[model samples]
Target: MTNILVVNSSALGPHSVSKALVDNTVEKLKLSHPDANIVIRDVGANPIPHLTADNVVPEPETDAQKAARSLSDELIGEVQVADIVVLGAPMYNFGIPSTLKAWFDHLLRAGVTFRYTEAGPEGLLKGKRAIVVLSRGGFYSEGPLQVLDAQEPHLRALLGFVGITDVTYVRAEKLAISPEERESSIAHATTEVEAVVNQVSAAA
Candidate 1:
């Protein structure tokens, strides 16, 4: 059976546009993959600890800290078992949330998710697809606000680091511009989600 890992990192909880988009995407996936085993990791409500000096100090940790470190290991293991990874990543100060970044730090382990090769670096986890659902308050796909978009590019680079080159981004921007625009943006994204679902279903 195909396995999927869903990571939700919207600080706004159920009210978040990014989270809603992710949920819709999952629904679409289920329509195609009826037997899909999906695992959801909600990093917003229960965030993993940031990698502090104590955690990465190259020294042994206390028992309690060691237990906390185990959480990161488990999350990385989940990625290894997944065939697809879906992320709900919203723009925070033109960047990704700290929680999502922490998840990446845990998964990007040497000799595990990646390896240092003579040619440079090679990813260990292959044949995985990632879909990032991005929601931004303003339009950033072009013009002046474009440079401020750190969400999509950062995710591409980091996920690609782990050998996930089959990646797609569904961006819902200008959500806060006005009520009409917000509704229209969401509807458009929903159509895109449906199209992707049809494609995946046909391929399946």
Candidate 2:
């Protein structure tokens, strides 16, 4: 059986294009692997508290820190146990949402998710694949605006840092270009979800 972990980080809730993309992606995965167990972390609806002085892991192990650390442990465990990870990210001001960033901050732990060695730093969580669906308001997939698009690159680096290097990207761009373009991008992403599921089946 496959273990799939999904993260939805768009604040728009019902009206989110990214959430729609994520739902489609999960449905495709289900069709491919009927026995797969899915765990969803909806950070948009319940945002993880940003790491602060109070929540940072402490040697003394304060009550607040303990609760924060436990949540981090749970988040890291989800990624470690999953065979596939599907996440939806909507661009905000040329970058990713702060809520999503907070989730990453909690999951990334030294000697837990990653480690340092003689060769160099290495990620601990291996043998995992990530499918990221990104929604952008402007033309950021390619062209002059690509450089300004910080969402995908940041996500890629973070995923790689945790040993999820087999990453695939599905982009919904030019959402704000026009109403017709928004609908077109969504229709295109829906097709992408099906393609991704067939293109990469469960590794057995």
Candidate 3:
């Protein structure tokens, strides 16, 4: 059976496009892999605290630091056990949400998720696939606005650093353009979700 880790990082709560897309994506994933075990992390609703000097340094830790360390361990363990990681991210100020970034920060432990080699840094967690759902208010996949897109690149680099190179992106853009555009974008994205099911099935 496959282990699917579903992470949603949109602070919009019930109104979040990214979170809804993630739900739709996961449903399709479940259809493709009926026996897949699902694990959920709703960081948007329950945001992870940003790393402080106390959390990152090697000095004697306070109770809060210990809790932070334990949380990081748990986050890393989730990624370590997942065969498929599904991420929901809505663009915020040309980048991903702070909660999601914090989640990534916790997982990127030296010698744990990655290690330094003579050749270069090597990712320890290998053989995992990531499906990232990105919702944006404007076009960023290509064209003039693409240069302003810091979201996808950051996520790709972070995931790649941890050996999740087989990453796929599904985007819903032009959301805030107009009502017609929003409807069409959502329809396009909904149709695109079927392709993901096919892709996963083919890999199986």
Ranking by lDDT: 3, 2, 1
lDDT of 3 by residue, 1-204 (tens): 899999999999999888988899899888889999999999999998888865786743788778878888899999999999999999999999999999998999998999999999999889988889999999998899999999999999999998889888889999999989998998888788778767877897
Q: Estimated TM-score per prediction?
A: 0.93, 0.95, 0.95
Q: Which candidate gets the maximum lDDT versus the true structure? A: 3
Q: Ten residues in a row with the worst lDDT in model 1?
A: 52-61
Instruction: Single out the weakest 10-residue window by summed lDDT for candidate 3.
Output: 52-61
Q: Which ranges of candidate 3 are over 4 A from the true structure? A: 59-61
- Candidate 3's displacement at residue 175, Å, is 0.1
Task: Quote the lDDT for 176 in model 2.
Answer: 90
Q: After superposition, how far is residue 91 of candidate 3 from its true place, in Å?
A: 0.6
Reference-based lDDT, each prediction: 0.86, 0.89, 0.90
Model 2 stretches astray by more than 4 angstroms: 58-60, 202-204
For candidate 2, write residues 56-157 as lDDT tens digits.
645527888778777888998999999999999999998899999999998888899999899988988898878999998898877898899889999988
RMSD of each: 1.7, 1.3, 1.4
